[model samples]
Target: MAERLADWKQSLDVALFATRMNFRSHLVHPGEVVLANLGALVQAVSGAAVFMLALSTTGVVHGWTLAQWAVLTGFTTVARALWNTVFFGTLDIPDMVRSGELDHYLVRPANPLMLILFSKVDTDVWVEIVIGLGMMGVALQASGAEVGAAVLLFIPVALVGSALVFAAMHLAVTSLSFWLRYDAMLSMLVWRFDSFAQLPMSFYPKWVVAVFSTVVPFAFVGYYPCLYILGKTDSPFVWAFPLAGPLLLIPAVLLWRRGIARYSSTGS
Candidate 1:
């Protein structure tokens, strides 16, 4: 047990060191970083504007008031931003596999997936984090939602779980590259499906809800967690959403291991 704990700590240190190196490398090109952040700022503003415009026209969506919808949207944005900031490297797996770049990761002492998935940081995504937090503040004020100790504690838990869910889905999809030789289409498809998660699951038809909650499990990432925060759900099952992150990770890790076992370098 001590040996395993020590190994885990070493892996964590390696991941953190790599992340720091990635940031320092980006700092060498400060101008490009600023420009990229500016572009991200525009996108964030546009997204928030779209939600505002929709609420202005309709005043309500499904049974949710504008404020409630804002909370949902805010939660979605924050979850997505966190995922992209931390695990954006997972999206590069297909390209790396296709180009034989993954060969470099295979020989490392640390876990290959850990090295590959956490080696890079998207510094520009800090803009999204800032904008997301601002939106959440506004939504919280507008909705006048009661905050209990449980809700406070669960906020970080939900965010971490939501990001992990996305990471798991991305890893599962990208691992297909090992056999299929191309996973870009499937990756894009999964990402497109996530757009549905921006809204409350209550608005969806029964079948859609079942599909997302079970087959995809995207609802646990943002929808169900937000419902719990909004005091709209009291089901004991909802408490399981945070654990869904590690549970979902199991299949992803298994598939990744299988992929690695089957891997053959392109001999570049």
Candidate 2:
């Protein structure tokens, strides 16, 4: 247990250092960061506007009031922002493999997966975070949900779980590049599936819900957690929803290791 603890600490330290280095690189071009973040903010605002416009006409979507939908949207946005900030670079894994850049990562003493995962940081994620929090606040006010201690504690857990679920999904998909060699279509498909999280699960057909909830389990990332916090769900299993992210990592990591073993450099 002590050895495992120490290894975990070391990995955390390496991840922190990588994050700092990426942040410093972003800081070197402050104007670029600001402009990029502004673009993200605009996109988020536009999405919120569209939701609001639709709600104005119907006042509810699949039994969820506008406020409830806002909460779902906020959670989804924040979870996705966390994933993008940490793991968006993984989307480039196929290109890296194709160009043999992954060989440098493999030769590093630190865990190559961690090195590649944290090598790039999207500073624009701050925009989504800010907007997401703002939306959550609005939802809470409109929903009149009590901000209790348990809910407060659970929020962080849910966010971490959501991030893990997203990261694991990305890892599993991108790792396929190791075998497929060049195509990014699978990764792009999984990435686009994130859109499912922005709306209420009830809005979808039963089959769609089954696919996203059981097959992909993206619903646990934001929907279920939001329901738990909002007191809309009574399932005892809701308490364990956070584990879904880390638990999914077991298979994802195994697949990634298999992919690594099969990787052959492009010799670029």
Candidate 3:
């Protein structure tokens, strides 16, 4: 038992070390880092200016003061930025599989999925996160919202939940590599999903909301949690809804594991 415990701890340490290494490698990649930062800056400036202009035209947003809208938009922007930075390659699984590079990944000591997910970091996305927080702050001030301890407590839970949702969704798409000869279709579909994700869920039809929320689980990306932060929903569900984002991983990871096993058997 002691030996087994030691082995487990050693593995955990290695995994943590690998994660740090992955982050360090990203910092060293000057070209990718610069491009990412530039993209992020553009997104942030464009989003903020557009929102300000739209709100100014109406003189108030849908029951949300200008500040409140900024908060929601801020969360949305930061969430997308973080996901793109960390898991940008999830969409490339199909290509990886087709090129037979996935075979190499499977032989590595660490988890293939983790390696794939953390391998890339576009530092430019940080711009979006920064701008997003700025927007949220503007919203908070406009809405006159108080920062109670309870609300602050929910922030991390919500953030982590958002990350999980991202991983789960990306994994799900990548798993198709096991079955499809090409993932061009999946890539196109997931990118389109991004635009849908950007829109406020309330603006969509009820069925559209249902499809993305329960079926695809993208709503958890921003809408549901943002609603809770806005005090738009008080259901105990809101407190726990963020948790639902990561829950998307259960099936996605399981499917990926199963697909990998089949791939191993086929040697393809």
**Candidate with the greatest TM-score versus the true structure:** 1
lDDT of 1 by residue, 98-203 (tens): 9989988877677788887689888777887788778877887788788788888888889889888888888899899898866978898998988788888889
TM-score each candidate: 0.94, 0.92, 0.85
Model 2 lDDT, residue 71, Cα: 86
**Could you give the candidate ranking by lDDT, starting with the highest?**
2, 1, 3
Q: Which stretches of candidate 3 lie over 4 Å from their true place?
A: 1-32, 60-65, 264-268
* Candidate 3 global TM-score: 0.85
Clashing pairs in 2: none
Instruction: Output the lDDT of residue 195, model 3.
Output: 52
The residue ranges of model 2 lying beyond 4 angstroms of the native Cα positions read: 1-15
**Which prediction has more favorable lDDT, 1 or 3?**
1
State the lDDT of candidate 3 residue by residue for 1-268, as single tens digits: 9977776565555556766777788778678878867876886798688868887777554455666667767776677767786678677788777777877666766677767766654556767778877777777767777767877788667877776787788778778878877665876677677756555677678999899888787788777887777777678878877777667889988988888888843355
| RMSD after CA superposition, every candidate | 1.6, 2.0, 3.0
